[model samples]
Target: MLSTTNPFTLKNIADYQYFSKEKIETAIQKSSDAFEKWSEISVSERLNFIKSLINTLTKNKQLLAETAVAEMGKPLKQALAELHKCKLLCEFYLQNSDFFLTGRKINTDGCESYTKYEPLGVVLGIMPWNFPYWQVFRFVIPTIIAGNTVLLKHSSNVAGCSILLEKLFTEAGFPENVYQNLLIPGSDVKKVIENKTVKAISLTGSEKAGASAASAAANQIKKAVLELGGSNALIVLNDADLEKTIPEAVIARFQNTGQSCIAAKRFLVQRGVYDTFMEGFTAQVAALKSGDPMNENTYIGPMARVDLAEEVEKQVNDSVAMGAKIVLGGKRNNAFYEPTILTNVTPDMPVFSQEVFGPAVPVIPFDTFEEAVALSNQSDFGLGVSIFTSDIEAIKEKVHRFQEGAVFINALVKSDPALPFGGIKRSGYGRELSMEGIHEFVNVKTVYIK
Candidate 1:
């Protein structure tokens, strides 16, 4: 049985029964059947359906936001922000999907030649719990609007959010089986991936899960898009405006209580300004409010579950044992982990090398701009990096030196509906937003005529 416990109260919220193998077979068939008729519709018709879905999201925003908070422990305000972002995703596709899927004319010797985008039949999305609504919408919105049906196998902890999402689709007038939630555990994910009717897979989770899913898809000769873990760096150059850089650095590290794959895990500051940055950064982190997730004013909440909090604690303790110093918070109470900062950290420590998924970060000092870039690229993850400096033009020339998927100057790295978001190396592969994202599950067909 799949179940959820409130991260704040540590009390059971609900339980869900896993789908049997036979039921999985039925769901896939239903999705395949739905894809045929759904894919045959006009792009204009699809946009109208998406408009209805957006309206449904608007009507049920509070319910959806609260469900995420009850299941995951994100602050209520942030949860609402997640729903809002989901709405923006739907609206983005609604406005541009027709153009995105439209065939393009190519200059060729033939009388008429061009390329067309067609959806793969049934695409399965394996999503995570953090930013539950936004993650699911980012993957599903574009895929379905491109004329594909979806089956979601969400994180076990956020089962409520998953089931509710399926219902929202139906309420929005989506046809039967257009979007179904598969209530199954991680073990059964391979079974779904191996199903012949399941054409493609899009997953957002840990490295191990992405590897396993990619392997299964490989064996089946099916395509998969994986968005995995990241230990991103927030590099503060010696010439950076500390006023602007310090506040963004705090939000980059501690937002969503630091449970994001794209959250800034390492702070690489130039030696000249390292001490000054720490003073302001530490003070801001200390001033953050912690309380019940449902509380509007709570800036910090529990880590989703007790085990997750324990994992962060282990990373912190191990780093301290390896000579890292805890300059600020380093305490855990059940599922609640205090916002933590570690200094005197080397690249060898767990906090620096591994993806820390809770409210903790490590600060490392660098001697030169080249060293800061090297320190940022030292990890197995290449999801993204952010550099803060006043010399935008000089930094622009050096942006190519960092081996990351995305980079932000004078700001934190973020995912936008209009921009492509994904990573290389251990962070997994394939894009997830914008034109590239909508095309990930589509067949780019070339046609020529005499």
Candidate 2:
């Protein structure tokens, strides 16, 4: 049985649901009971549930987008983008699950043999707030379509958004306890993870949180996947088109108001074009419009919370004190942090090494492609890196040698339903947005007969 606890938070918001020890235990128990029947239903039926959920989401994407923006401070455009991605993921899986999850036949020595894909049973998703709605659905829809039930323990800050999702599933005719959301506290997570019935775990959070959760799951010898935050770097070669690359750097660093795990934080530019790149990039950063996220014109919003914005502010200022030069911005008022750009940033600076989870960017100069690659891979976290160069050979070499989970050539960092999303080192290990993702929480069994 799963041990549960109460939800602990600074305050409560309406439309959120909290699960008690008894409640979560009951839900898991119910899920375990339902799995007997739920797992037996044809994969087609399971997918129908997902389709219904998608249809329901499409009908109310506006309200859901607004709720997430209110709860987590994501710009409304990005929030709606998250909703659209979630819907797209659902439809993609609905059309492709059988191909990804179906049993595959193997060539045997004159005998028949095949590999079977089986559910992991009672999978728990411990997700984050930056992209609340999409994060949960990115893991949930695929797991459900694979015949696995989901138990979501979302970030406390986005509890309101999480509950709305649960209600949507309920309204979509998902049976009780199927794809359930638990608005519980941090203390409760360990208990649920330890439960013998819960077969595996997936988390998207901080390095500290991922380490703790990975340790807990490891101690029990259970399967777990972690998608921790990243300090991804973007590299520009000396041969790159400065005009084309500089503007791309602005969007790459400032996307999501610069709160994404995979957002480009460090810009490694070859010294030949470094000054020109910084001139254009810094201008773009300084001119960004920051205000209420609900305002359509606002590209920059509050940093999800005032404390987070303050921490980022401190990190940028400390970098400046450590010999980093603030080329564009380094100010904060209330929750609004002006998009910041720092040049003369060395690897030793904190902003260069740490995950600056706001509208802050640091630019470093390198002399050669080798130095640029070295700078990009020096960090302990290897989530993603973007290279802006017109040299096809250099792009190939960087893509082959860059130690990140994903490498983008002449483009910014991104996540797509078609590609596997994960990281190595402290960025955490687990694919979340592709077929590889659907397999993360499942068991591959070898069914052989003598």
Candidate 3:
């Protein structure tokens, strides 16, 4: 049995029995069957169903947000914001999916030729607990609209949210089998990926999980899209406006309690402004309210689970042991971990070398803008980087030198419905969101008329 315990109170929220082998088989078959009809429908017709989904989500947004807060430890307000973002994603695709999926006509020696975007069959999604609703919706909305059915195996900790998501789709008038949530453990995922009916897989999780799932898909010669871990750098130049940069830096590191994959983990400030940046940044972080996630005033909450908190505490403690100085908070109580800031952090420290999936910021001083870029690129994860500088035009010229998937100027790294979001290297591959996302599961076929 998979049980969901509220991270805040440590009480059992719900329990779910894992899907048996027969149930899993039935789900795969149903999704495969549904794809036949779902793919046959025109893009305009499919969009009508999506419009209904947006309405259903709006009606139940509160319930969805509350469930996420109970399951994970994100603040209630942030959970609601995640649902709103999901809605925006749905709206964005509603306006643009038809144009994106439409075939392109091309001149050819034959009578006529063009490229047709056709839907693949059933696609499997292996999603994580963080940003549960937004992660699933971003992948499924586009996949279903493009005419591919989805099979979701959500994290066990968010089982309630997962089941609720499937229900919302049905309430939105989606057909019986277009979207199915499989209550199976990670061990069972390989067999499902190997199933003949499952055409592709999309995963948003750790590097280990990505490697395992991606290998299974590769063995089946199926496509895989992964949005994995990140240790993004937040670089502050000497010329940066502290008034603007400090607040953005605080949000970059501490938002969502720092569980976000794109959340800035390292603060690489130029030596001239390093002291000022740390002083203001720590003040902002210290002022953030930490309490029960349900509270309206709460900005920081527990780190999803006690083990997760323990892991983060160890990362902070280890860094301290390695000559890193803890400037602000670094205490753990049950599932709650204090928002921590570290300075004198060297490249070899755990906080600098690894992805800390908690609210712990490591400040590393650099002498030059070139050194800042070099420091930012010194990670195994190449997800993104946020550079704060007054000279936006001068920084624009150096953006290409950063070895990251995205570079944000005087802003935090974030995912938007209008832009492609994904990372490189160990952060995983392929893009999600925007035009690149909807195309990931579809077949780009060549049509020829002679």
Candidate 4:
């Protein structure tokens, strides 16, 4: 049985019976069978179904948001925002999917030459707990709209949200077996991946998990897309406007209790303005209120689980031991970790070198713009980087020097429906959103007719 415990109260919220091997096989087979029909339907009809999904998401926004909070301790407001994003994602596809999927006419020597995007068979998505609803929907909406069926093996901690998603898809009038929620153990994931019916796999989690999943898919000779861990950096230059930069920096680091893959994990400040930035940034982090996620007044909520909190505590303690200084909050009470900032952080410190998936931000000082870019690029993770500066042109010139998937100038990094979201190096491979994302699981067939 899979049990879900409320991270806040440490109480068992619910227990779900895991799907047996037989059930898993049956579900994959059903999805494969459904894909045969689903993929044959016209794009316009599929988009009409997406319209229903948008309506369903809007109708059940409150219930879905509450379920996310109860299941994983996300702030209630953020949870609602997640649901809204899901609706908008569906609408985005509804507006652009036809154009995205349409075959482009190519001018070639042959009488007729073009490329067609065809759907791959059933694609399995192994999603993580952080931003559970958004992560799953981000994968599900596009995969389905691209004419592929999806089978979700969601994080065991957010099992309730998984069930709600399956229900939502059904209520949206999707055909039976087109989308499924598999309640299976982690060990069972490999078996599902190896199944002949599952054509591709997508995962969003730790680097370890991404490696394992990618290996399994490779062994089976199937395609895979991974969106993994990130130790992103928020670099503040001397010319940056502290008033505008400080608040965004704080939100980039501490939002969702800092459990996001793309959240700014390291703060790199130029030596000329490091002190001033720290003064304002530390105060903003200190002012955040840590309490029940359901409370409207709460700015910081508990980490999704106790172990996650403990991990952050250990990272902070080890960094402090290795010569880092704690400038602000660094206390942990049960599952709640105070929004923390560590100053005097060097390249060797755990908070700077590793992916800290909690509410801790380490600020490291650098002397030059070159040094700032170097520090930001010095990570196994190339998920994202944000540079705060008044000179947009200067930043743009140096942007290509930073090794990350996306770079934001004078702004925080985030995922949007119109852009592709993914990372490089240890942050995992392949794209998640946008036109490139829809094409990931599709067969791009080139045809030449004389």
Q: Model 3 — which ten-residue stretch has the worst lDDT?
A: 274-283
User: Pairing residues by index, what is the TM-score of model 1?
Assistant: 0.99
lDDT string, candidate 3, 1-450, tens digits:
889999999999987899999999999999999999999989999999999999999999999999999999889999999999999999999999989998899999989999989999999999999899999999999989899999999999999999999999999999899999999999999999999999999999999999999999999999999988899999988899999999888889898999999999988989999888888888899999999999989999988899999999999999999899999999999999999999889999999999999999898889988788888899999999998889999999988998899999999999999999988889999999899999999999998999
Per-candidate TM-scores read 0.99, 0.94, 0.99, 0.99
lDDT values of the candidates?
0.93, 0.83, 0.94, 0.91
Which stretches of model 3 miss by more than 4 angstroms?
none
Residue pair clashes in candidate 3 = none
Better of 2 and 4 by lDDT: 4
| Pairs in clash, predicted candidate 2 | none
Residue ranges of candidate 1 with Cα displaced over 4 Å = none
What C-alpha lDDT does candidate 1 achieve relative to the native structure? 0.93
Q: Which lDDT tens digits does candidate 1 get at residues 191-261? A: 89999999999999998999999999999999999999799999998999999899999999999999999
lDDT top scorer: 3
Clashes, model 3: 0
lDDT of 4 by residue, 1-450 (tens): 988988888999999999987899899999999999999999899989999988888999999998888888999998988888888888888889999999988999999999999999899999999998899988988898889999999999999999999999899999999999999989999999999889999999988888999999999999999999899999888899999999999889988889999899999898899889888888888898889989977778888889999999999999999999988888999999988888888899899999999999888888988888788889999999999988898778877898899998888999999989999999988998899899999999999999
Q: In model 4, how large is the Cα lDDT of residue 398?
A: 76
Error of 4 at 333 (Å): 0.9
TM-score pick, better of 2 and 3 = 3
lDDT of 2 by residue, 1-450 (tens): 222111112233454446778998987777777666777787888888888888899898999988776776778888888899988898888888888988787776747778888887888899998898888888888887777888899887777677789899998998777778876888888988899888889999998888888888998898888999889999888888878887788888887889899899888888888888877887777787877788888788777777888999999988889989887778987666889888778888889878899998888888878888888999999999988877777478547788889998888888888889899999988788678988887778876554
Q: What are the clashing pairs of model 1?
A: none
